[model samples]
Target: MSDDMLRLLPWTTPDGKPCYLSAASDHSRLSLLADDVEAAQLDSGEQVLDGARAVLGDTKAGERAVRFALTRATESLEDVLRIAVSRGERIEAGET
Candidate 1:
């Protein structure tokens, strides 16, 4: 299988484990599922960012709330980075 077919799973197992799958076609079941998950994650992240901004704008917002939002944003960013790096590496390697 080519590295280009490899995908970084958006979510972990029920027990909290990382998962990876590879498919020759993006239309495959696994690939579609991953796409759905990535879309969800991105949507959720956007919401989180909006919420964070609102909180930051509030004069009553506490440090704890800001910290929590930062933490979640960091996690979402990490997931995005993982996906980007995986795809970038595969492309750089010219996987076929």
Candidate 2:
């Protein structure tokens, strides 16, 4: 398959390797599922960012609270970054 038709999925393997999808078409079943997953990930990332900001702004946020927020923010950042790379590749490949 051509690079234009291949897509980097929003998730990874059990061992932390990246996942990919060889979409048959724009509206393929797997492609649509991936789109849904990506959308959810993006939304979750936004929520995590907001919560992290709130935690940071809190004058009395304890160590545990700050740590938890930071951890969640880190995970969200990873997801968002992967999404960016995936989308960027698609655009560059003229698949957008």
- The model with the greatest lDDT is 2
> What's the number of clashes in each of the models?
0, 0
Looking at model 2, residue 6 earns an lDDT score of: 72
Local accuracy of candidate 1 as per-residue lDDT tens digits, 25-89? 66788878877878887888888889888888989989999899889888888777766765675
| Model 1: CA > 4 A from native | 1-5, 13-17, 93-96
* Shift of residue 57 alpha carbon in model 1, Å: 1.5
User: Deviation in angstroms for 32 in model 2?
Assistant: 0.6
State the number of backbone clashes in model 1. 0
Best by TM-score: 2
TM-scores for candidates 1 onward, in order: 0.73, 0.90
lDDT of 2: 0.87
* Runs off by more than 4 Å, candidate 2: 1-4
Q: What's the lDDT for residue 71 in model 1? A: 90
RMSD of each: 2.8, 2.2
Error of 1 at 66 (Å): 1.6
